[model samples]
Target: MARIAVIGAGMGAMAAAARLAVAGHRVTVYERSATYGGALGAFERDGFVFDTGPGLLHLPAVWRDLFLKTGKEPLERCVGLTEVDPASRHLFADGSAVTLPNASRAGIVSALESALGAGAGERWGDFLGRARDAWDRSRRPLLEEPLWDDWQVLGRDPYPALRQRRMLRTRQAATVTEVGALELADPRLAALFEGCALAYGLDPRRAPASAALLPYMEQTFGSWYVAGGMRELARAVYERCLARKVEFGFGSEVTSIVVRDGRAAGVELAGGAVAEADHVVAGADTALAAGQELWEDGDVRPQGGPDAGQLPGRFAVLLGLSGARPASAVHRSVVHSPDTGAEAAAVFGGRLAERPTVTVLRPDDPRIRPDDAHEAVTLTATVTGHGGAVDWRDKALRERCAEALIDAAGTAVEDLRARALWHEILTPAETGAVPAPSLAGLGGRYLHPANSTRLPGLHLVGGHAHPGGGLAHAGMSGALVAGLIVEGADFRGSQ
Candidate 1:
């Protein structure tokens, strides 16, 4: 059995720890906080509970597979899982809205036709068809496996953008923005298409058309909500790791990864104590692992493009409402900004939009509320934070941003201000920005570093690593890292 030291008690780290332990490796997880679940955090006050991280789960089969691999009990047995019907309701700035049915293309197409116009749904459906093609082409290399050494091949966009002929000039939609305008046509439909990209902090103007896979995955797999809170998913994974005999050191922060003979020796703690291991898996930021130099020279380092440093911190505003959730409420809704272009510019420019696109999540779970008379809701928007340009620490600034979210969310929740008993704002200061899942285009700028780094015994996993972010992709990150470690780098994921 090999002694493996995993950094951070995040979901990805714990997933790797569990799988490694099940493979007979002695795994120890080191987290700086007093708890597990890096980005998966929760807030509770009185009887209200809220997920500070991702509020919904998509492609839950990933976690289901993890649970099955780690133990006999499946994911459903560990946590209360329910499919969110009407996957999401989209409110365009044009005052037109459409409620998308869960996992039913026909239903969604019909709904869009009713809400937008005769050919609107057909156009959106056509786009989804192309998006599905993109998903099929890139699913293997971009996800479900280790990022290849020749990842540059993925730099070529997989999205089969339609060739449009205008007079003598032949035009093909290259970026997501062009796809929305030249293909989707209607401004409302365009916002819905680009809104999916914007939610991940990807600027629609620059994000490659392959980013269409974001909504494709969601529509195909459907959205799911965990009972209690999303934090429960973290708890279940942490418990699974424990059951697999993976040890955890909660309050133990890794200062550096000790190197011996140019391979990963182990980890050095905050107080200079070393925990030696045969291999090291970094499920957190590798920059801080060894003075921001661990990935220098010939290593597959983190990308720092125009949207760099880190993806925009998921700016969340948790609301504690006094009224009971309406019986007709959908699980989630996206309130598009009046001007998405300006909104993207503001986020990338280190500012907040006057009317930003806001995603409102109101799960129909009693575990999150004190009683049927009360409700807990979360509103999220993507904004720049990695750079020091935006000061999130300022209370006044946070409140101003929170107010903007509340105002923007008014479309989804009636009398939102009056119904609120209290509110909590999570800025970049508390949660830090989250990386989106790797996209298959933009000259591979959207792809994450390979899980197998140039550092021999050191591996990178989690949202910031291969397969990239999002709950499902993070699970894949853990799996890929474990496969590489256990199978000696020849592992190419499930055949």
Candidate 2:
């Protein structure tokens, strides 16, 4: 059995480690933070529990498969799954609200017809059908293939691959803003689509067409909130890894990928310690270690700034309220600002916008929260990278930016500030500088560039790689990397 070292304990790292261990490799995971779950994990503040990252759970089957592949059943280990109806409630600038339901094409059409208009539903149907087709085509080959070498897979059936490429190319033409214009008749609905772009630190005009699948996935497979908090899901995965006898080294940051003789030998930790392994899988941020400083012959290298070719960064305010608000919904409420594209463009151009799009998350999904306590809410806005000004050492600047984000979210936040039991604000700089390796944090590097260099045995497995970020895409990338490692082993055996 090969001795493998998986760097980073995020979902991708843990998933990769579990798969490797179950495949008969002795796997060890090294994490920089004191805890596990990387971006999918949580932390506690005051009496309230805050998910440091990833609040909603969608495409859970990918997670289920990860555990099951390692000989543990996800269903048996955690609370039974609960489907969230009306996937999300969107509030537009005009104050109109629309709730997307969990249903079939016919059901979605009927609902849209009633909410928007007769022809609105048909437009939605056509849009969703095309989106679903794109998903179906890309899910297996693109999402589930090692993005670094996806050309090999695409070469298998060139025609279909070419067709898929054509779809992607055209989809790029209708930026998120363009999609909003073409897809929705109601100004409120258009803003709702733009709000989705803001949720991920993207401008509606630049956001990929593939992102349309997010709403589709939520509506089809359903969104879920783990009981207690989203952290439960992370805890469950960690326990599964433990059960499989995977060793972990928390508070141990990997400093570099140590390659000897053109192959991955192991990794060097932050404190001059070297951990040797036959194979190394990097769950950490690839961009952090891909430059000339880390590996001399790495496959993926940084071509520009931290956000090069990546989605935008975000600033957030987490509020622990003393009382609940009626307007707050079960899952998420997105409020789109006017001129979302211009707002996003300004951020990307290194100027903070006067008005930013807002996305709010409530921890008290009635199914998860009990009847007596006040709810916890997180309000976030997209921000421009202040050229590494995110260092928390600049306390006053951080506070000012945090307040600005809260102000941008408007009156709901005014109520929050008045009654909030506890409040914590995080900027992209702060979130990006969480003591973990640069790229490992939630807002680390954005989507890596195509044709970039890659580390020897170290593979990029998260939103930082191709096909871009999001829970489903990240999980799929992890699965692809795991499969590649397994296949490589088989190839070695044949030799």
Candidate 3:
């Protein structure tokens, strides 16, 4: 059995620790914050609970698989899953709105057809079918298995093996902008699709085609809300880790990964206490880890094209309301500005725009929100730049930007302000201070092609890697990294 150390206690880290422990490795997790869930955590004030991150859960089968592998069933631990009707409500600038049904490809197509045109439904169906194909092909080899090091389990040339297994080629998937342009018949509808890409702090044009599978996953498998809040999922995962005897060190910030003799020895805490281990898995922000230059030989640098360092920071604003909006759906609601595409380009590509696209999530589902007296709302907007001296602390500028976002959402936000029991605005700078920086630049490296680097004995999960951000992808990333560690090969080499 290997003595393994997993850093960070976010969903990915927790999931990795549980799986490694179940596999008979002695595992311990170290978190820099007092809390365990990282972005999945929730904060409560005066009977109001707000999920600071990931308010909705999608592709629950993924979680079920993780639980099954760890000898714990997800259904048994928390509220069983419930399918959300009208998976999401899309409000366009043209004063038209459409409800996307959950898992009903035909229904969604019909809705699109009714709202857009006669052929819109069929076109969407075709697009979704392609996305499903991509998801099927990528899940096992790219998501489930490690990044190609474990030769015995993955065999040689996993990509060919995957191809033989019939996984879809990455090149074949639709780019974010392409999906927006093709799947939705209307330019306004297409703009709405582009807005979704911004959720991961990526521009539709720059985002990989493979990412189109994200919306597909939501439509096919459906988005879910755990009773009480999405944070419950984090709590349940933490419970599983505890059951597996995985030790957790909260409020313990790891300063560096100590490398000895070309191998991971362990990590040194912020105050300089060293914890030794046979193998170390860094669940922290990839950018932070890379910047520290901790790994042996390999550098945890950002990958991708020349303009990588210029990638913008991930930003959002969370709001809590006193009363529920009757028009607001139970699970998620998306309100877009007139020029969502332009707004998205500005946020992700480092351009500035006067208006920004916004998405609002309110869990009115009985299971997720038992407290009917009050409603919890999260409004997210992507922004560029690290939350440094210039951006975060500029009081006047920040307030102006925040107000602009609230105004762009239309009168619902005005109503919310009047009835709001409590609310807080979170900037990228605040998000960066979390266990694993949720914002783009501060946590991990920027989203660049050529600047990418890999380190020995350390792997990156979550928004920092190839597939980028989102709850499901991040969790799958942890599984993939662990699989790589067990298998023993470089990500590309495995393919």
Candidate 4:
């Protein structure tokens, strides 16, 4: 059995470690923090709990498959899983609203028609057809397998071109914004689609129309929530890793991947101790790892693009309210920015938005609160991920941004400000404080670094690697890495 050393206890890294150990390889995970689950963190205060990272899971089948492969108990048994019906509620800038049913295209079309207008439903339905085309064409290549050697093929936009006579002059909708303008042809509808992309940290203005797969994936597969906060999902995976005999070294920071004789030998710890291994799997930030000299000479450097040295981060506000949640509350609600074009300019080109689109999450689960008398709410918006550009250290600035988000969420919740007993602000300083996944869309390259690098015994997992960011994408990265190490580079994918 190969002795494998995994850097970072991120979900992706641990997922790979568990599978590799079950395959009979001896594996150990090293994390800088005292806990597992890198971005999947939880916060608690006075009996109130909040998910500091992703509040919901999309395409949960990725994790479901991981559970079945690594252990006998299915994912359902590990955690209390529930489908979030009326999947989401949308509040458009135009004062119109729609409630989308979970994974029901017909229901969504009807809701849009009733709320927006007659043709609106038809228009969205038509867009879904086109979106399905993109999903079918690219899903396997983008998710199931490792990024191909010639990943440039993915850079060629897969969004189908429209044949309308007036649109004939244009070859196709090149970017997601163009898709909204040319096809959807309504400001509200465009905002709806763009809002979804922004939540994933994609710049809707330049992101490929193929990014439609974001909403399409959610609508098709359905959105799910764990019994408690999303933190429970992370805990479940961590337990599975332990049961599989995968060792975890918390508070152990890796200084560098030890390279000997031109291959990854193991890892050098912060105190200068060395743990030898036959292979080293990295699930840390790709750019940071390279800067720390984790790779030998001529080994591939992961970050090279127009978006050099920058990854988008999230701004969040967690609220602990004094009142109990009303029965009408939906699991998630997105209040679209009043001026999306201007908001996009600020996020992709300038500073943070003065009035950004905000997503509010209020799970019905009672585990998040002290008692039935109290409630928990979380608000989030995507911002430029780098901490250097804007100083998140300023308390006044964080409060202003937090207030702006709370105001934007007013349409979804009543007396949003007064009802809060207290609130916590998590700026790019906190969310971006940790090295989260970089959304890959610079210069039309959707693919991140390949799992197999120039070094023979080194592999990369996590959102920084191929298939890119998000909880589901990170999980997929781990599967691809394990498949490569066990079956060799010739390994196509997991069976």
RMSD of each: 1.6, 6.1, 6.8, 2.5
Candidate 4 C-alpha lDDT tens digits along 241-342? 999999999999898877778788898889999999999999875442353444444332455322443656789999999888999998899999987777
Question: CA lDDT, every prediction?
Answer: 0.87, 0.61, 0.62, 0.82
Better of 1 and 4 by lDDT: 1
lDDT for position 62 in model 3? 66
TM-score of each: 0.97, 0.81, 0.81, 0.95
Candidate with maximal TM-score: 1
Over 1-495, each residue of candidate 1 has an lDDT whose tens digit, in order, gives 999999988888888999999999999999998999988899999888999898999989889999999889999999999999989999987788999999998889999999999999999899999999999998988887787776778889999999999999989988888999889998998898778888876888888999989988889889898999889999999999999999989899898888888788899999899999999999876764564345545444677532664467778898989888999998899999988889888887778788888999998888989999998999999887745688888888889989999988998999999999989889888888767778887777888888887778888888888888788888888988899999985797844
Ranking by lDDT: 1, 4, 3, 2
List ranges where model 4 is wrong by over 4 Å: 164-168, 286-301, 304-309, 433-444
Question: Where does candidate 3 stray beyond 4 Å?
Answer: 148-175, 178-185, 285-301, 304-307, 310-314, 324-330, 349-352, 365-371, 388-390, 411-414, 433-456, 484-495
Estimate the TM-score for candidate 1: 0.97
Q: Model 2 lDDT vs. the true structure? A: 0.61
Between 3 and 4, whose lDDT is larger? Answer: 4
